[model samples]
Target: MAITSANQLELLQTAEAVAREKMIDPELVVEAMEESLARAAKSRYGSELDIRVSIDRKTGKATFTRVRTVVDEVENHFTELTVEEAKPFKEDAAVGDELIDEVPPVEMGRIAAQSAKQVILQKVREAERDRQFEEFQDRAGTIINGVVKREEYGNVIVDIGRGEGVLRRNEKIGRESYRPNDRIRCYIKDVRRETRGPQIFLSRTAPEFMAELFKMEVPEIYDGIIEIKAVARDPGSRAKIAVISYDSSIDPVGACVGMRGSRVQAVVNELQGEKIDIIPWNEDAPTFLVNALQPAEVTKVVLDEEAERIEVVVPDEQLSLAIGRRGQNVRLASQLTGLDIDILTEEEESARRQAEFAERTKIFMDTLDLDEFFAQLLVSEGFTSLEEVAYVEQDELLVIDGVDEATAQELQARARDYLDEQNKLALEKAKELGVEQSLIDFEGLTPQMLVALGEDGVKTLDDFATCADWELAGGWTTVNGERVKDDGVLESFDVSLEEAQNMVMTARLQLGWVTIEELEAKAAADAEAVAESIAEAEEAGA
Candidate 1:
């Protein structure tokens, strides 16, 4: 094949046709043709020569050139030349200047034409992938209508207009099967650029899919009058969605439910009859949790904010109802509220409370050498720990019935003496466990905390500094959709995460591992980043 005047126009025509068929930029196809032609030209000419090609977009003309750079010291003989040697190409050539000489187009042989065709095909495929990735990357977290193309090993391949989406078996609703050419709606879970092509992952079981379905059905949600706060689903079985209405006149739950249950029913049908409970969202977590556990009355809700756990007490009969089949109801409620919920009957809660009270009473009785009656009196007065009795104001103790000033003084003295003895024992134990003096001298760590750390093999200040905040103050980890508790070395001493971080940083500073300037600079950078985020948010709101 020769690049003659007759074939020059043919190159541009072929590029435009390929670009139109592939739905890519015509300029990209023309560039690919130029690159492929240049590769062929390099084969005909010296491979070491810097050959270049350009195609005129308007005239459909191809120009080939050999370029060499003028340099003070030439190392690459074919691509670089001295200023004197470049004088033949350009009379006033200087160092660092490029000299170009027009060259005739290559008369490509069978092997060369085949290689060029492969290059053009590879470039077009790459451009197609890039186009697909750019088109769908922004469509992630949205819903799309697609036709089922095929099923490959339990994965459904859908023809989603310009691209194919893979709906993994686990992402499909339970027992829901589709035939080829079946029309289906799915959520665009993700769009990823891979070696093969752009991968579009579709999901029918995602919680966001249900929320989006409601947005499509309910005008209020789409118009921003009502917002879906959270969603939790056990796909194809049951789901809970919490919504809040910005307009006071609009009832979020009623709006979502629609007249005669039309709106919610539409979403439920699309989800393969996944039952949905539309609950009104509340700022108070416990109140929101109460709404999440629908059709089951809650007598009381106790929340532990630090641990993100909640305890719900209900009527004895409602226990089974609140728990639902296989604890599904409580599990959904926990997911909706982002808390670990422990549901209990009223009887069970009462028994647990009685047991705690008895335990507290016994602790006071044994520690303070008080009789059962006196310990019960102390426990009834809201004193749960020896530290509370030891450090509480004398007036607080005097307020208790039948407790005079003398009795209060004696109680506080005994409490303080017991704490001092315990502290001494804890310190001695910590030293026996190989705890260094530097760790004992470190501020913010109590004797009991030191003993705990020593037992955990964190014997020196250096070891403590190396520990993570969660290692000192317990945290929760989500594994397989369940929150698991991670025990901390100083959790028993009520060490908060923030306090643990500060103590560790202080230890590092004392060891000169970090300077004050570095800390100040990091704080400034964080503040600047926060300020910038606020500014961006304000601009977006405007």
Candidate 2:
């Protein structure tokens, strides 16, 4: 049924063959051909014109129809068709639809045949590029094979099958060189197309470059006994891979190491002698955190779950090693774990615990009650004992974001309850750990001073600590309307002019109405009332 003369008939087979050799689908190639021909036609004529092509499955016969845009004033004859002229075949054709005209065999001369050939070839190339683009784009960070073409702009151009891929300067592994026509394998980073053609961008710098190489060398990785979850690299210098396995019987780290690290050694050699650390991936945050800070054993892990922070404590000897030079160890671990990791030495941990202890104690005195988050905050602060909190100073505790007056009071009460219980359990422990309880001295402001203020009541340390430090002397802390100078307490306490001015503002979280001056004025009024009562009593006695 098929004729021998059909180069026309064999056209479909030829197209399919081209697509196959390139690992491209025939249907896709056909689509690409159609798109390319359409593009070439529009470029030669105008975008206002349309071209359509059809291929016969039986004989490979192909045809092209020119479609013109309907317009009143036709400047471009190839595209714009006069409204009345396009009325026949253009019935349903709107402004956007094309008025297609069939070109006779005679109209397609030898030159036209040549032009058609160019269009088809150009289109086929573009389609091939697009197909390659779609195929390799998602394959970024994967290994692919290509031959070195030549160097340009200090970069290597690798011929990747259907496309010419570039290996940019920075993407080249350090000291790793290749010559023209040399067969090389690198990672496919990005794939795109330009006027030049399909670019199957290759890289030796991608983190997975090494992983892929290891996959080829290590059978276990190919067999799925080992899985690489993440990788980080200082390309050409050193690389680290985080791997895990499904079976508990299998050790990811050991498997990658091979019989004697030969498998991994081969990969390292391919990297031009780059150092590699094969650390075990872990699900336990603590265990994972410890492993992530490899080469240095972690003694403890303090985790702030809500904040996604982890503090890794190591022995004094391992501190420097764990943190690495200039904090590289912790920095890379943070990247690997995807967590903000803080590395601490034993001494640092101990000091931090003590400081945190002071913070909680202050919080207890100011605010009563401990929430889970606050407790975590306390832990992060480095507080290990309740006694330490009892004696904590305001300056130290104020640094924490959430430790307000109320929270401080709660912690103080809890610390008291805790101390009492401990005292009952071990008098010796109580003696050794002397209970520290200090009444918050509101400078010299008596309870009477607070009672004198109206609905504007004192509730927070800001209310009390609002006492300007510059006010060397203090009665009831006074605040001027906007400045601290006008507070009655300022004069009563004989505070410095600077201190009174500071109180007027209550800098951190200043109150507009009830400032230092307002509170000081009320304190003065209360003091005057007490004085008057004393005088009246004396006069009545006389």
User: TM-score winner among the candidates?
Assistant: 1
**Model 1: CA > 4 A from native:** 427-446, 458-467, 478-482, 505-522, 532-542
Error of 1 at 255 (Å): 1.0
TM-score quality measure for candidate 1 = 0.92
Q: Please write out the lDDT profile of model 1 over residues 405-483, one tens digit for every residue.
A: 9999999999999999999999999999999999999988889988999989999999999999999998888899777
Cα lDDT of candidate 2 equals 0.67
The window of 10 residues in a row where model 1 has the poorest summed lDDT is: 3-12
All candidates: TM-score: 0.92, 0.55
| Model 1 backbone overlap count | 0
Q: Which candidate leads in lDDT? A: 1
lDDT of 2 by residue, 255-317 (tens): 888888898998988788988888888888878878878899988888965346788889999
